[model samples]
Target: MSSSRTARWILAAVAAAGAYAPAWAAELPDRTPGLWETRALIDGRYRVVRRCFKQGERSAFIDAVGVGACSASAQKTIFGGWMMQADCRTPKALLSGKLLVSGDFGAELQGRVVTSVTPAAGGPVVKRTAMTFSSRRLGECATTPRG
Candidate 1:
């Protein structure tokens, strides 16, 4: 066979392999859960959006970015949004952190106003997180909404 024919066969084989990879890796979950958007501070430089799911008995926290990242801690509070206790609870969180949504989804940070966030979840999509925080913070500097 000519070299051209050999190359064509190799390309066809590669294409076939590529097509099946995703199908094989596809997850068949017992429950396909819709994630709730939670507000979280990321790296103290920007804000992030996160989601939580029930993975078996334990809750899972995920940073909703271009890529998915699992978070360690998620807490639910009185309001909406979330305060990622994973690493954001620490001081270094200012530099590197992600908003985890689990335990409590978008409940803690609903009213708390802070400087920065990570993973940067912005725009009209998560207006709830933004609206609640800005309304309380800018609306009144002194008597902030009680949690």
Candidate 2:
């Protein structure tokens, strides 16, 4: 094929991908991080939680300590990287300031909620939520645009 023809083919492929971009963007996940801190509402006031984690890392010894379960969403740049927002709540909701991750299987933005205003002893255990952003090299959250 001629060079011009090859270039046209590449451009066409890119355009096709852009059309369904939003759905794909929403499906992607965030990267993992070494340490993270965020604000929270406690007794009608706000506080922060800072944590340390590693990929494929879990502790059975601390099962009694309690760990939170959370969820997240992501936004994609024209390039391959992403910005993700994770929520770990009683009702569960997204938060401000998204964590960024690479195109390589976003595992950074994860969350959980383990506490609740209501106790399980009354009936069932209600849980509180917490957001965990396992991310790219701490500061790799920022990236350049593809366009």
Best by TM-score: 2
- For 1-147, candidate 1 gives per-residue lDDT tens digits of 233322222222111111111122232112122333333232232333333323321122111111122233333322333333222222112112222121221122133321223323432221111111111011211333886
Q: Which stretches of candidate 2 lie over 4 Å from their true place?
A: 1-31, 57-62, 65-147
Q: Lowest summed lDDT over 10 consecutive residues: which window, candidate 2?
A: 11-20
Model 2 lDDT on a 0 to 1 scale: 0.31
Model 2: per-residue Cα lDDT over 1-147, one tens digit each: 233322222222111111112234355432253443333332343344343434532222123212342343434553455443433232222111233333343223222112222322343433333222222233323344999
lDDT of 1: 0.24
Task: Go through the candidates in order and give each one's C-alpha lDDT.
Answer: 0.24, 0.31
TM-score of each: 0.19, 0.28
Q: For this target, which candidate reaches the highest lDDT against the unseen true structure?
A: 2
Off by over 4 Å in 1: 1-33, 55-58, 61-147
Note the residue pairs that clash in candidate 1: 41-117, 41-118, 42-117, 42-118, 46-117, 75-104, 76-104, 80-106, 81-106
